[model samples]
Target: MKQFQNNSLYYDVDVKIIKQSEHCIFYEMRNDEGKGSIKSYQVFPGIKLTYNDFHMGQCPYHNPLHKDILEINHCREGRFECNFINGMYTYLGEGDLAVNTMVNNRIIDSTFPLEHYHGVSILIDLEDAAKMISPILKDISIDLYILRDKLCAGDRCFIIRAKNSIQHIFSELYTIPDEVKYGYFKLKVLELLLFLSIIDTSEQFEKRTYFQKNQVNKIKQIKQFLTQHIEYHFTLKELSKRFDISLNSMNSCFKAVYGIPIYAYIRTYRMQVAASMLLQSQYSITVIAGNVGYENSSKFASAFKAVMHISPSTYRKSH
Candidate 1:
């Protein structure tokens, strides 16, 4: 096994895509064990994004070294964990943007939720990016070198919430038409960088975790247990007590690890289970709902429609 220090950051991260279109390239990402159906996208030169469904059950951390570039990651659907080399943990929740600059000294790895994690990543090549923006910032006292220093000099990762400006940018990226995505992506990428550069960096940083490893292992266990038991009901208090952790600790750590709260994860997993049952089993809708922990068929139907975007019967008929 090669040590992370010697490995290329882009190595092993290059997904093999069997399909290609004008705007997006589709690829499948497998686990270390080599049994996977995880599908992701490679958006041109530097951006890689994934629109995952119920996949990626065991994705190990990636700490590869890459050329100097800044990665702007956004969490649109479920959550994902982005960990820096210095022990700081940043959870990209829904509508959250994580700004990380890739450095040779500091490698990184990220874990997506067990299911339903959709996000976009835009990588700006340091040389090309600086050339485009440094002149623009000449009158302003800000330079790409300064921003680069702040991002990579020490332990810093800028975590921005989903405000209107950020939201609108991602919204366009998410829904950009296929014919225009190639050019539109370039424009949007630059637009987003300018937005980030202008933002007041004073309050854009959050220092939450410097992980101990064992605690993170416990949280991973929590995710594994909940995903396996889709029929069971879980509460924060019950889980925290059962796991010998404080409620706040459980909440924050779970968010940090899984990108959403415990209950929200449970709910998403429940709907996924129901979806599979609808397609695979001969059971009626009422029985299927009860099997996934819902007593009232109507309520189960509502929740299923909310997550899967169709009623049980409709889904069953289609699939």
Candidate 2:
């Protein structure tokens, strides 16, 4: 086990390497709050699989450590955000699957909601992956290397629709017993590769979208602005004028980065703040809702129920 300071959130992270072999390396990660336990398996020269069952409050920003690594992520239980080197962010909600990479050691930021997040990740090294699949390259036009380079050529990402095949592969991983996990693990990786190899046409690989670093940063600034002024409401036109961007561009960019419209992000943040107040303060429900930017209790309750699935009083009492 070893310890390191995560620069992004200024928190300590602990890692325990359970095994390190030429074919596979197994490890686990936890944060100081005991809210996280992420198990990882690095398979040989090219592939890695991770199962995340943790609640690391707000994980700090960090770059991918591998060279030429490409990631496929599926969120099984909770949602989070993935920030790329180019400043863009993607949301990984339950059942959402995505592939992303920026080639090398460039930084990628991550944010987790304030609860347990369970997910699975599969990473592939382009060069090594290409070599492993060389035997099949002679017949197919889409080499994994070519697929990565041409498809992701730049700081790129794709939110793939979760098909039954991908879902089945991960569902098995979640349920496989310890006795045969290793063999099943290898089989699943092969199955995943096979699925990727045949699922898309050459052009379909290029269909995904990405955002710019400056644009992403702009949205981040807007998020900070909203956080600081939670009681105040801003409209799309107001935000666009404030940021000196077009309305359509702002909407698209904001959705691309944060995975929701601007107002949805605001409401989510407001409810989260309301939740904290409910637990930590003696404020009345109406007062708490007002403090979090709601003018009417009924409206607040409806909105809260939409995101939290419970009434404020119930949530407060339960906690």
Which candidate leads in lDDT? 2
**TM per candidate:** 0.71, 0.72
Local error of candidate 1 at residue 293 (angstroms): 3.1
TM-score for candidate 2, residues paired by index? 0.72
True-vs-predicted CA distance for residue 210, candidate 1, Å: 6.4
- Which sections of candidate 2 miss by over 4 Å? 1-37, 42-46, 53-71, 77-118, 124-159, 206-208
Q: Per-residue lDDT for 230 in model 1? A: 69
Query: Whose TM-score is greatest here?
Result: 2
Identify the runs in model 1 with alpha carbons over 4 angstroms from their true place.
1-9, 17-67, 131-142, 151-153, 177-186, 207-212, 284-286, 294-319
Residues 1-319 of candidate 2 have per-residue lDDT tens digits of 1112211121234555555554344445566655555465654346667777767655433344455777788888766666666565556667767776746544466666434578887877677766766664466454676656544555556666546766887887898898887778777877766666665545344343555666767777887898899988888889888987788878887776566788998999899899899999999999988888889999999998898999999999999
Q: How accurate is candidate 2 locally (lDDT)?
A: 0.69
Clashes of each: 2, 1
lDDT of each: 0.66, 0.69
For candidate 2, the 10 contiguous residues with the lowest summed lDDT are 1-10
